[model samples]
Every structure is written in structure tokens, then in C-alpha cells.
Target: MQHKYLPLIIAAALSAMSAGANASGYRFGSQSVSAQGTADSNAAEANDATTIFYNPAGMSRLDGMQISAGATMVVPHSTFTDSGSTRFTHTPTGGTAASDYVPSQVTAPSFYLSKKLNDKWTVGMGMFVPYGTKITYGNTWTGRYALSDVKLESVTLNPSASFKLNEQHAFGFGIDAEFMKANLGQAVDVPGSVMALAGTPNAAALAKQIAQLGGNPALLGTAKDAHGANDGKDWGWGFNLGYLYTLDQNTRFGLTYRSSISHQLRGSTVWDFSKVTTDPIVNGVLQAASHKANSAALVALRTPETLSANVFHQFDAKWAGMADVTFVRHNRLGDLDIQFPGTAEGAEVIRQQWKNTVRVSLGGNYVYNDNLTLRAGLAYDESPVKNAELTHPALPDSDRMQYSFGANWKLNARSSIDLAYSFLDFKDAQINYTNACNPLATACTGNGETTRGTFKTHLSLIGLAYNYKF
Candidate 1:
């Protein structure tokens, strides 16, 4: 194969990767241990350096210098049970079985540092992962032609400053430098491709030539699968702002907004046709056809913006309450457009049609004594994915309920340790999608084979942190 054909092969692979899934559009909720303890209602409490992420304005309330470091272990399980799925040719493909497709565990970590520079000003910095996930299915699964493996990872560096404008108000601002990497893999249906190609005028002549070359024409159109993979990385920038108002020393309100960032990912894709057939002529024709359809692809992706508001009230020195409501602009992710520069094929647009979502949380903290504090919280999070038809295997997301509990152990006047645990229960979802085999069809239902199935997921998270002041 010529070197120029390599880009085309890779482009096709990248297209498959772009369709993989992300939970709640790839939002991670474990930015702070204290926040997680209260189901992320700490936006107005701002009791530690982690305010750099929740509500930067809270930094103005900190005295001296403080540092907080933590990590959250996320363990998730997802299983898929097929209902009655088949290949495009209406052949049974064994999609009506049960399998586990999600990774067992992943970790999200965070670190923050804040310094009171003056009587009314504070500065802070943080490092964290806001979006990430991994999903994999068996190679022989019925949906192998649609998806097999996908992984997305990201990290952000944030620097922020807060100003105490008066006794009642404070404001904060920050800049975000984020980096992301993605990988995807899927099986390619070679036999299906050959059958589809048979519609061309030259197919008959090609078949004759293959027969003369001692090739079996019947085998050319038989079911066979290949493999394709792609990986890409990019960097993006955005900003966040926050405001805090104090009704009294015991009561406060907070609001924060994080802007969206856009990325143009650069990557390579590769295809393996070894499993297609051993016939050189057949393989050559397939490779040439694929090369003509592929190109060096550039994919554009965007991270959604977020808005959150919270209230923190101190009932007394020993007891306090907090509540929060957060909005995610997931609708910003409408579709992924993959472009092959200088090619007439234009861009491959994959429809996502995601919807915006919200999260609501309620919690309380009780200071048992100078040495210990206990916390508990509950939350409801909406999924951006609307229905089963649009749900992809890479991200079988659903609405979720989260229950959390935590504690703070005071080591000294200026030091403490925080621990928290949360259980996330996701509603079971059903998927009934088919890869469109007919080019003129408006939906997958009538144009191709259907992969009908059900998905179930559950997640557990444990967080630990050490906080200190100087």
C-alpha cells in the first residue's frame, strides 16, 4: 500500500472513535473531598483551599496560607444484556447475550494551594481531572462493527485570585489550561463492505479477474471482520468566575461559572484487514476502496460550560447546612464534525443530540467536638443522554442518585484530615440502535440490523484529603 493511503485508513478509524460515550458528558464530581461529603454542596462553605475550584471567592475567607491535597477512587460497573440483535443482512449475531463492558476502577485526584496576600486579597492554584472515562466490549460482540474500546483522559491547571470588596461581598476569577487525550478501537465489517461494493459497475469485472486469479468469488462476500484504531490529543483554554455574598457570619451564598473550551484534535488512524481474507486481490481492492474513502482527519471537540449556586448556613457553631444546584450546558455538544482537509468528501458529521442537565444536592455537617466533624448528603444528577436509541456503548449514561457520608478529624489548630464516601446508583437504560446500512435512510431502525439491549451501572467513590494551614 502507498504511504498516502495510510491517512485515509486512519481517518476512518478516528470516525469510529468519535462516536464513543462519556458519562454525563464526561463530568467528574470528585473535585473536593469536603464537597463530595456534602454531595458537592461546598460552594458557599469554602472552609478550605479547595475553594479554588468550587468558588474562588471563598479564598478571601481563608487566613494565612493553606494547602489541600486529595484523591477520589471511582469504581464503576456496567453490564449489557442483548435482546434480539442481528447483522445488516438479518443474520443472528449473538447480540442477545449478557456481558460486562466498563472498567472496574479509575481515580480522580486534586490539589489546591491558597495564600492570603493581603487583608482583603487571596491567591490560589489547583490541579485536577474534570473529564475522563474508559469502556470496552468483546471483539466478537454483536456491536463490534460499532464500538469495541474507548478511553478519554484530561487534566486542568487553574490559577485564581479573590478580592474581598466589602464586609458582605467577594469576587473571584481564574484561568484554565486543559489538556486531553483520546483513544478508540472497533471491528470493521469486511464482508459487508464487499457486498456493498458489489453495487458498483466495475464489481463484476473485478470478480471475474479474482476468479481467473484462482480466488473464490463466493468467499469474497462472506462475513469477515477487521480492526481499526485511532488516538488523538489536544490542548485548550478557558476561564471561570465566582461571587460570594454574606448575609451574616453564619450565612452565605455562592455562585460560580466555568466557560467552555474548544479543541482541534490531531491524530492518526490505522486499519488491519488480516482477518478479511487471505486472497491478495480481494484485500488489495478493499484496501484501495478504504483509502479512497479515508483521509488525514481533524476532529473538533468542545467541553461544556457549567454554572452552580449554593447556600451555606451555620445553625450554630456545632451544626451547619448546605444546598447546591448545578447546571451543565451539555447541549453544546451537538455533533462531532471530522474534516479531511483538501478532500471532496467534506466532513463526517456524527450526531450526538445531547441535552443539558442539572444536579441538585442537600447535606449537613455536625461538629461533634473540636476533634471531629461528621457529614452526610444526598443528590440527584440528570443525564445528558436523552434515550436508549442515542445511547452509545462507550458511554451508557443514565440518571443517578448519590448518597454520601464523610468526616473531618482535626489533628491540630491548623491541620485536619478529610475522608468521604459516596454511592452512585444509575437507572437502568435500554439501547435499540442499528448502524445504518442504507445510505438514504433517515434512521437506523429500518435501514440495517438492530442491536437491542439493556444497560445497568453502579459507581462507588472514596475520597481522602489532608489539609494544612501556615
Candidate 2:
């Protein structure tokens, strides 16, 4: 567990670069219980207050005051098998393959309240988790250097208003207040860094120190139980707009747009070397590194914007159908850059270069009786990560299909309950990522170490919501 001099360098790198993307795979898609039942395709048919999050314009079609509260439980599973992974020394970084790095269950919650002021005015507020994810790949995983643990979460509060232009048109706008929290973790290959430091001025001194701790080449791939991590939080602002156009009582269309948000998270670097420190070398290195650093770290982050269109049609007295198409401008997060206030380390970067993405869904509802309705839906989700080489373990995202089912039970004139279940089937994805072993390197997928593998993953969601009308 004792280290020589490289842990200090990796500590600085981890502190500066504290952000990464988890994208569609971990994007907290179950925003509403009602919407989840329809694979989020019922935007034009917003029947409850949750419409405030999807398409506020639909609020114009509601009666009086209404409220909705819900929560969804996400269950995920995954396994990764290594094919060919090598380190900065071009030696095999042999370690255990990962399995179910993400937790078995994660809960996402939402709330909404809407009020109809008059025939032409409607107002509402909504709170929800738009993006969230947490992962732990163990210390000895094949891709430990690239990533071992990652936790990121965001919450949004939206205050919205809508106006009914006439029986045929409505418009809505909302302002968003978002909060973000992030934690990033990885391993610092102590033995492997011996090679990365080959030409550095401190090379000789470092090698002498390592040799004192039994410099063993066999320890190259055998990572110590050492783990490094950093954390930060911030707040950002954005806005959204929606429009609903009614063709007739039985048919309607909806359009919505959400703006992007920019955030700067400021934090100081924190390091824990206890697990890797039985010798005084690690402590000495830390003290020296501390004297030279005079700055806090800052991570710049950008959330993508999105546009969507939807249609709802009534086929008969007992049948209805809906569909939705959405565009996600993920390219806005092409890269994550971090800087130190008073250091020459320049900037550390994780080259995501994510591309834009699209999602499509279709759903249907059957009115079984005066108080019950059954729903079923299907959807396709695309990943913004286009190149396999860019794939990293922090976010095991990929293309997938979603199948959903649910029911709505009207309890009385003023109350109802919604129940839903959904399953995501992801395509087997490949990981061909390379992680830089040092801070001075510059490459989208790293140039020093490569982790090659195939990943299999999937998820399920169960949600429940209660709705009330005044």
C-alpha cells in the first residue's frame, strides 16, 4: 500500500478534472409517473399537473388547482469483460473485470403544482431530477486508471406560466434553477508512473525513493488498494418554452424547448493516502506538493439543450394514441475543462466530443371503464457517444429500446393514482478507451493506457404517483 512519488501528481490531476458525462443511460428519464407509462410520448395529452415539466402549455386544458407527487425506483445491471488492456509501460494492466458497478436501486422523485387563474391564464411549478448516476468499479478493475467511481446528480426547479390564445392555441414559458453535485474517483498507477516520469527533472530522485520501497516490476499491474477522488457543487439557470396547437377536440400537437445551462464549480483538492501509505514516502511527497500549490480548482460544465414535438389523437370513444420525437444537443458538452487559480498545470481535460442525439416514442391508452385506464408504450433512445474509442466506464451508455406499461385508477372526483413499469434493453457495447497516465498528456481517449472490453447492461423502472384536483 506504500507509494513513491506519483500519487501526488495523480492527486492534482483528479482535483482539477472533476466532471464527466453519464448521458442517456443514466439521464433519469422517468420524470413523471403518467409519462413513464407512455414512454414519455403523451406530451400533447398532459392530463395532470405533471404537464408543468413536459409541456406547460397543456396546463391551459386543465380545470382548476391540481397537484402531483411521484417517485421512481431505477434498477440497473451490467457486466464488463476485458479483451486487451495495457498501461503506460505497454504492459498488461491485468485486474478483475467489472460487474454491476452501479447500485442495484436508485430513487428519483418529482413534484408539480398547477393552478388555472382564468379562461386564458395558467400557472405552475415543478421539481425533478433530470440527470443522476453513481458507479463503483472496485480498485483492481481493468479500467481503474480511467475510472473506478463517479457520482453526479442534478435537480431542477421550474416556475411556469401559460396563456390560451383561443380554443385552438396555447403558449407556455418557464424559468429553471438547477443545482449540480459531482464526485470523481480513479486509481493512480504507482509503478506505471515510473515510466511516465522518464524525462522529468525529478525522475532520478523519484526512482531512488521507489527503489527503497522494493521497486518490483511485477507490481506494475497489481494496483494497491489506493483510490483518489475529488468533489464540487454549483448552481445554474436556464429557461424553457412550450406551445400546444389543437386541431380539433380529438387531436392536438405540442412543441417544447429547453435551454442549456453553464456552471463553474469551485473547490479545493482533497487527498487520502492512508490505504497506500505504510511508509513515510507518501507523507513526504504530500507535504512537498502542498507547499507548491496555492490555488483552488474550478470545473466548467455545460448541460445540453433539447427540443421536442408531440402528437395526440383520439381514435374512438375508448381508444387514444400518442407519439413524441426529441432532439438533444449533447454536443454542447463536447469537452470538460478544469483550471487551477494560481498554478501552471494549465488545464486538465476529458475529451468527450459527444454528438447530438435523438429519441422517439409511441404509446396508446385504453379506457376500460369510467374509473380505469390501461396504457402501453415503446421507445428508442440513441447515445451521443459515437466513437467506441471515446467510451469510458464513468458512463456506460449505448443505444437502447424501452418497453413500458401502466394503469391509471380514478379514486374519486378529485383524486387518482398512477402506476407504471418500464424496461430498457441496451445493445452490447464495446469499450476501447485509453486513459492518460499523467497530467501533461493531451488526447481525447488518452494516449498512455488503453482499456479494451465489451459491456452488457440494462435497467428497469417502477413508479407510482398520486394526483389531486380542487
Per-prediction CA RMSD (Å) = 4.8, 5.4
What's each prediction's TM-score?
A: 0.88, 0.88
The local distance difference test score of model 2 is: 0.72
Off by over 4 Å in 1: 1-23, 95-98, 195-203, 209-218, 221-223, 292-295, 342-346, 436-449
Each model's C-alpha lDDT? 0.73, 0.72
Backbone clashes counted, model 2: 1
lDDT of 2 at 399: 84
Q: Residue by residue across 101-170, what tens digits does model 1's lDDT show? A: 6656677789999999997899999998877766677677877655666677778899999999998999
Q: Top TM-score: which candidate number?
A: 1
Residue 352 displacement (Å), model 2: 1.1
TM-score for candidate 1, please give it. Answer: 0.88
Q: Model 2: which residue pairs collide?
A: 1-276
